[model samples]
Target: MHPFSRSQEAKEMFQAQSHLYNHTFNFISSMSLKCAVQLRIPDVIYDHKRPMTLIDLASKLRIHPSKATCLYRLMRVLVHSGIFAETVVPRDGKQEEEIKAYVLTPSSCLLLNDKATGLSPFVATMLDPALVSPWHFLGDWLGGNNHEDCRDKLNNPFEAVHGVNIWDYGRKNPEFGNTFNTAMAGDCQLMNLVIKDYKEIFEGLNSLVDVGGGTGTMARIISEVCPGLKCTLLDLPHVVAGLPESESENVKFVGGDMFESIPSADAILLKVCTLGIALL
Candidate 1:
């Protein structure tokens, strides 16, 4: 073999190895983001009202002195991922010295607890063990090793891991059920932006049904945007049970299964249903 060809092959092999290593460790980024959200780092930074130094942030988080260095490392990863921004600012007493401070980036702004576009609940719920555990069994489920009967109704990883579907699991675990509901509502906050850009879609429609709408967050947004349009929110009986009535005359809630029947309406809105059982 030519010497140049051998060198070129070695370079390509090293590149492939680097690519593989990156993909294998990509979950660290997601887990780190989850950790940040769990600690309410975004909210803490926003409450600070300015770029916050590492020491001040550690103090605000009530982290121990021993863990301050670990906090810095975590923040470094978040800053690299663009979840937070780092800036150099003048030290309090040292005119010639500067310190690195953290600020909220556009992505982290959505994680703020009090913001209109807040999705902290969604982040927490999605990263919860109940949801993430399914991924561990995904390979087994796909390979038909998780179940004795491949033709069984349990066709998804969540069902294979938990021995029941997500809906049933939610019913069995009330706390997780509430968390999931809150997360769904929080996730729907993005619809506010969508409605603003596409308000014309609802103009001709007199009535619309939001199938499997959890707690009517999306329905309320639509109703407010299109006051003339009537919006009906339909979901499982247990999901809509004991919910307070909507203040808007144009919005109403109904308890029913989407598989059996859906309320009649001029338009049907189905958003985020594909991951309704698992990821969403």
Candidate 2:
């Protein structure tokens, strides 16, 4: 091959290799974000009420002295991933000397534990070992290597890995079940911001049914924005059992499977019918 052609081919190969490496290690970014949430990094920064120096952050975290540098390295990854922001500021207002400080970005702001829109629970739950372990069996499940009877009955990688469906697994494990419920509620909180703007959609509608509406977070939001629209929240009997009554006259809770029979309404809302929850 010509010399220039050979060099160009090598360059292309190197670019391809870099792409492969990045895609292979993408999980590290997620794991790093999970670590930040586990450490309450966002909450710490948020509560500090100002840009926090690295040393101050470490001190607040109460991590051992030896791990301070490791914490910085972890922060570096999060900063690069846009989960946090780092900037240089004057040390104690002295112009000549500067120190690095970390601050919450919009993304990290969503992870604050105290905020109504906080998604820290969602982050923790999604990255939980029980939820993540199924990915390891994805190839096997797709290759038809799972037990024949199990494969015949199971629907997805999660069921194949855990030997049970997600709902059953949640029922069997109370701690994880609470975490999953909190995560779902946290995730649904974002709807509060946008539901009001779409109030017209509920106009002229007398009633609506929210299928799989866990704990009625979405129902309450809709009812508040569209006061005339009566909202019925439906889920498994166990999921809706013993729930406190809503203050809103427009919202009511009913427990039943979506597949069996959904309450008759002007419209049906199925917000969480995605592949992860529904297909599994």
Candidate 3:
């Protein structure tokens, strides 16, 4: 083929593969986010109070100086994905150095743990390996029947692959359970911001039930902000077990199965698991 014809064919091939390229590299985005969380990059940047240069960030991250180049490459991809932002800062008048400094955008801001509107937990929950691997079995699960009997089969793709529900697995593993709860609490923190904005939702509510309300984070926040409204945290017995006996006047804990029967309340806040939400 002529050189011009070959160039045209190459461009067409690239266009055809563009979507597949996106799909394949999607995991890199998640992994990059995961790396950031693991390295506490968001927290570091937040604490820095200013954009952090690559060397400074690497030092803060406890990464050796030799790995600085690798860090820069990772940051480049993250910046491209909009998880981190890069800016040029001038240190001295003599030379303006092109240093890669990370600044938090709306996306990275949500990853902060201290911020009232932080969504770190949502990220942790969504990216939980236990929860994520189930998606691979979606096609296989959907091939089965649609009856109530299939509910277990349908709702349990994770179990099918990993041999246990996420909660069960978390229970057996303390660190993972902590990570899961942190994520949930983070999500609750952010959600409460929205809920507070819509206070009318609780204007007439004397009592409210947070179904599957692990740790009562959301319910407690609601109860605290709206003192008159009593809150009940309804969750699995296993989840509520060993949690300190309630001392808060506005909030009470009730351990029970939401699938069978929800506790009686003026309002019910059924916080569905994200994995469950995704399946539905």
The estimated TM-scores of all candidates read 0.93, 0.94, 0.82
Model 1 lowest lDDT segment of ten: 144-153
Which stretches of candidate 1 lie above 4 Å from their native place?
Answer: 145-153, 273-280
Residue 199 of model 1: what lDDT? 99
Q: Which tens-of-lDDT digit does each residue in 181-259 have in candidate 1?
A: 9888888888899997899988889999999899999999998898999999998878899888889999899998898
lDDT of 3 by residue, 1-280 (tens): 8999999999999988997899988998888888887787899998999888887888888898788888988898889999999887765423555554689989998888777656766676677777777788777666757566443463467766666667678788877787776667777876777777887878988999898788778987888778899898887777787887556798888888777898788888877666566433
Each model's total of backbone clashes: 0, 0, 1
Look at candidate 1 and tell me the lDDT of residue 23: 96
TM-score of 1: 0.93
Taken over the whole model, the C-alpha lDDT of each candidate is: 0.87, 0.87, 0.79
Off by over 4 Å in 2: 92-94, 145-152, 273-280
Candidate 2, residues 1-280: lDDT per residue as tens digits? Answer: 8999999999999999999999999998999999999999999998999899998999999989999989989999999999999988899899999999999999999998888888898888888888888888777777785465676467888887788878788889989888877787888889887887777878889999999888888999998888888999998877788888899989999988888899999999989533275334
How well does candidate 2 match the true structure, expressed as C-alpha RMSD?
A: 1.9
lDDT of 1 at 59: 93
